[model samples]
Target: MEMIIHLIFVFCYPANNRQKLLPKSPLGGCHSMKILAQVLSAALLLLLSTELLAGPLSEYRSPVAVVLAKDGHWLATANQTSGSVSLVDVASGQVTDELACGTHPSFLQKCLDGQHLVVTDTFGGKVRILEINDGKLLPKATIEVGFEPTGLAVSPDGQTAYVGLVATGEIAQLDLAAGKLVRKLEVGAWPRYLALSPDGSRLAVGCSGESRIAIVDVPTWEVAYTEKLSGGINIGHMQCSADGKYVYFPWMIYRSNPISRDNIRRGWVLGSRIGRVRLDDSEYREAITLDVPGTAVADPLGITMSGDEKRLIVAASGTHELLVYRRADLPWEGIGGPGDLIDPKLMRDPDLFGRIELGGRPMGIAMADDNRTVYVANYLKDNIQVVDIESREIVREIPLGPSISANQIRQGEAVFYDARHSLDQWYSCHSCHYNGGVNSKAMDTWNDGSALTMKTVLPLDNLSKTGPWTWHGWQVDLNDAMHKSFTTTMQGRRASEEEKEAILAYLNTDRFPPNPFRAKDGSLSAAAQRGKRVFESSDANCASCHSGDYFTDGKIHDVGLGADEDQYEGFNTPALVGIYRKVRFLHDARARNLEEVLTDFHSPEEVSGTRALTEEEISDLVSYLKSL
Candidate 1:
């Protein structure tokens, strides 16, 4: 029967045409029936082959965040890649419920009321509230928010919600009772997390792209201060001390500006560290270094302190470990000095308590009242690792759902996000191109085979279409480009041919997100419509270079913006589909904003031709460019 089934599937769905039978998730509607068929087929296949079952047992469906239920009897996980939330019984280590949520639920938080859970659907651009009853989750309501809602924080009173609009670079305040948007407050670039103080008077927004935290006064809804974290690139989960005296979070630390992969081998460039900021004074300091001299600790995602304030736990996503530090052992004083840069020896390190091997990337962490019990969302493994904090051991591994079957694209994604491929398990491709997006940093990659030359990191959206990769357009083949990246930028050994092929398959899956500038009716605005004319017109001549649907001629050209340290004369024209989310512009990150890209950097002849339009026309053109 198994042989006959295999023969039928292989003949009917043939390996070469198998992709057609598979569902195209991004295209949605038309592929629903096909998707269902594919799911059934996958289920049947899983049952037939016991060897293939291991994949579903230990792979990630992109678990984003984890939160414990009110009574501490259940754990809820926002599985982004799975587009659902898993509710697990704490005592039994069994998934009691798998509640379907909106598309790509990235953030999950338990409301102050204890009976409610707030989930942020990033791609769906909505916030979903679910009711918890007898350890099961039921959809309560959903409110549409801004584009790419990445963070969620319910007000202390549970009457209001502050959501971070990642693509729009603003925070939308939602009135839960009215089920309407109260207002929008502008903050830093790409705010990933919104952490409210214990007293609820202040809000700290972690701006990952800009490397700063914007502190907002809750009553006024205005940003009163901004704390700049030195030596950090991206900041993650944050929590305020119980007394509201300090805010603790994890951030990636770079040894110097314009980081190079060369430093990875020398053990100087990349590291992870916990940062502490005084709430009252806005004083920021690097509290403890997670990585040592030769080995890197990798991406530190979630962070939280124990109830007794004795232990500091960090979820090291890249390294797949839970890093614990004793509060008493940390050198609180004389930090940010020469003595702080030294690496701590794991066995003899005074501050280092223990490193618990999670065997999968951990995303979010929550501790119980006892402080000894901790719940961790093992992102890649699709399980909640119940950690005994005092013993520094994983006591239980609760399976959330059936393991997701891995394909070439999924395997490629695993390679992309896996830090083990890098030297000393430092960083992964995901660290720079976050979720196949931009990191908003300029780095001396030496991709053109020259030193001391810097280029702004570009977005990987629709990367396969924009090839001849790199600023200088050196490597035309996608596979070769990926292989070179692994060896040079990651400073790791060359990957096998199979691994290279998987990476290429993963790159082909990337697509641009929906533009937020469009009207609710899915029509272009008046400004954007006018700008579209300017873009395609002879006056602008923008269509000559940026011609195709992916928006690039696939050729290098010199618009006369080369710097002294540039390795190449002309840079590759980048795709502008998701340009609105970019924090910096130009090949070298010389322009800070979109306006400066056109005004100071872009040549007049390249943009306006002979016709110099009015300010309105320029504004319209800018609007249209962002809409693409």
Candidate 2:
């Protein structure tokens, strides 16, 4: 930057401004100076381009979240891949400005102030508050919340906000007026989405990790009750009814049955659902399955209701479509037990619901002021689609930025999120490995040729660097492993050779997020330093197998964490990178956190039969482990 500035100054300006002396320009004359200035400008652009290109510039403006402004003039979108916030003009349909917020901005909402917007940097663990002025967005403040923050809910008055820390299992309460985090309220495992009642009396927390919703009383600032949703995972956006009577959300349920054609045909393998929790009574809840017999809905993510409360909308990202229903006609008494909640015949009733197809992977949905139009954040298409509810057709496709040609990585990413390739359109690879990371749930993938033997989903951080995949490390062929996952686990069609290559290309690009626990200078803390010593010591015997920059020797060991029904004898030595981002640990995911991993199942003493680690050593060791 300094060099560029110096070159620009010398080439674009006179050498002297004092003593009535005009020194020779770099190129001799004024006209020459202009040409030189042009050259310097091009060089500056190249430098800046080089920097941005070094990142994932090809995946520009992949909007994952969408929200309408208070007045509905501006529609703001959080583009996950490009790490930017794009504001589009509803009146002109032009993207006025795109502001770089942070790495992986996944969620955004209008604050109580009406002028400022709150955005969650999912991977950076920060909440960015930006003030809206005309068409430009100005950064007001950036507050550090917690690790892997995603979902967010702002108070009615806008003075307070709650951010869901996905990996940490807590909600960070922010004092927006003061621009800082006030406190963290523990909800449960994977508290990733939140919703506030209209009167601001209660907060509905979607704890996907435990498949429950915790309602926090506002006045007391504590969890009032927990509404359990059995067999529920992949909990999406939650919206409280205008009457504050119910909190509605969309999610998928895995029945945990064996992967067989019989199970898949019976809808016991996987199904999509939209459920609601009665706010007044915690015990009262209802859900309706969106899937039919042959044509099923997969990955129902975002949900919203019309202003008139006549229509309910859900974005099925996996299917790339919108499922709409007549709000008053919905089956609210649905109790999911013994194959009861799902009635494929209900889909035949035209008055009940309808599904409208949209291009690309639509994850987020926002309604216009008229309530008849919706703005969808299409992930694969790199555009925001405007759909008219009356016609059930797309009115327009608004691109936030210039579109680039699709490459193998992007195409494979599309495949990763697309559910159409799966049998009955049930799920995609992204359904399990969400955003190329673990979904924090262990399940039967049939990878080990075992039944009901659930295994934790491994993180794909530095995917290319970590080879010899799978828990047992029995699979040697990468392409074969992917083909098996698609065919056996998903019960989906086998991908062609070209498609498999593209999928591999996308996987190779998956890398771990920056470690927030480390110092800004990338130096380990004092506690981490001490923990590192203990980790490498002979007493711990950890570094012997878990060695290298990737933190794994690509070997398998028993570690006593394997199950009895396992097909393989020993489990693979997993990498330690980004271990802090995981809520569940161990091969079978028996341990809940790092603390449990250190003290219980795979403790230092248990693994190696050596000296037992002291309490202080465990604490420091856990701290150091989180720094990974």
Candidate 3:
């Protein structure tokens, strides 16, 4: 009977695309239905396998730097949102560890031993060291530093670590063995990345604020030489060739006021180039200026040279690709010549030689042991993309999440929504507002010739909960405000209805990140406590304008902060939830810091309409406002 049942089953099964006859059964055709179900299941499995192979390998959310260590066996990335570092094994393409750091880990550097990693928290104003043990990262120590510590460097001997204090324009040299500050070198304005010559005799520090490179004597730690560049050079990352004959610096025009619609035309107009300065002499020269075909500027970020010194790799941060140039092919006509003397026509075009779309903001880059593979950190994407130097193709991508997707509700969303335009090819809203709002610096002029003001531009996080937008309170709804600002005021291209909706969806659900302002027991700072008293006091009366959770009365009042008599009049009060992110204070952005905004209130130019408070009271108010 079993042999007969097997024969009947074989007869019912089809073969070679040939139809099979159903076997007669005492239980009717239930067996045939079961066979059909099995066939359907096999087909579904095949389709699923194809999709699984074809889907996006990984996604990054603001992945800023990428480095490979463990002899090219591991990949690490610094994620901006979760304030964590992700470690991935190259062989399996798996995330082995996700190590937490201070808030907003902007830059990462691996120690000489590859057993430790240091990350700079720009917003948190601290540096954290993590130890890698058995492929897992363990938090080692956290060191408090100056405000906005950005770029980082480890000495050639690995005895000293250099930390770039961006806001203060100083370099803090820490003794690695002792784990203490040995010296603080005041270099220049807005010092970014540090590069030491291969000989270890000189240190090349790029100052974005000064638009110059300060070459410091390694032993003496003094400014041995300074070479200036033309235009507003916001120098980012730098690398010295192993031969020590030349130093290559990558710089972009600094965008102090990134939000004004005019910023695109003005900021993008400046030319960008890789400057080559000889270490032997203080002569500065343009080695090569990378011009994108049709675009006015190129913002180069990470730069490195091949071990053989034959090829130079630059991560064009603005264009979202890696740019490579042959060292031999570069024309040497512009060395030690003036800016205009460098023939713009002879410059290498990044798109012509080699360009690969990594689909993220590429910041820091490092090469593998073979020098044939390059790793790029996609800052906003939250992952490291591994590129094959020979093919210029993305060989592998290591994810840095469970990342916050565009759909994820985060506090930055509201600020990003108010800052970004629908049709922009590069950058989002928060790219300019930074954490959420402005950076408090005056530029030549805004697109509309109106002075940029945080007191005017309202936050978007709780917009649905709050009504109206802008300092004038002109637009009633968030959607309308975005449309009008992007299209009309900023001159950003009009957004399609669908794109606008996607942007709005992203903005409406932004939730604030965990506040670093709170104490261990969730109490406010003592300064903030005193500040609150001053804020509610009759003399200050800050609550008269700013009130409620979003910290706005949603009303307009003239604070008088400009030379134009008409502008001296009233403006709508903006929300203060994330006001601390803004560097500049007031409508004109004249106040250099928060203290100036409250203390300088008595000046006719600043307090054209409002009365000034005493310095002590102003300090108290500032302390209180920061608590929020």
CA lDDT of each prediction against the hidden true structure: 0.74, 0.81, 0.62
Off by over 4 Å in 1: 1-60, 256-262, 265-267, 333-351, 520-522, 606-611
- Which candidate number would show the highest lDDT if scored against the true structure? 2
The global Cα lDDT (0 to 1) of model 1 is 0.74
lDDT for each residue of candidate 1 in 401-513, tens digit (9 for 90 to 100)? 66667677777777887888987788888777777887767776656777657677788877777887898887788777777788877778898998888877777763334
**Ranking by TM-score, best first?**
2, 1, 3
TM-scores for the candidates:
0.87, 0.90, 0.70
Runs in model 2 deviating more than 4 A are 1-52, 57-59, 334-341
lDDT of model number 2 = 0.81
Models ranked on lDDT:
2, 1, 3
lDDT by residue (459-575, candidate 2, tens digit) is 776776777889898988888998998899888899999899988888887445678788766799999999999888888788988899978999888887776799888977899
Model 3 lDDT tens row, 349-440: 54234666665567788887776688888765667778887688999877665555554332223224332342232234443333343322
Residue-pair clashes per candidate, as listed? Answer: 2, 0, 18
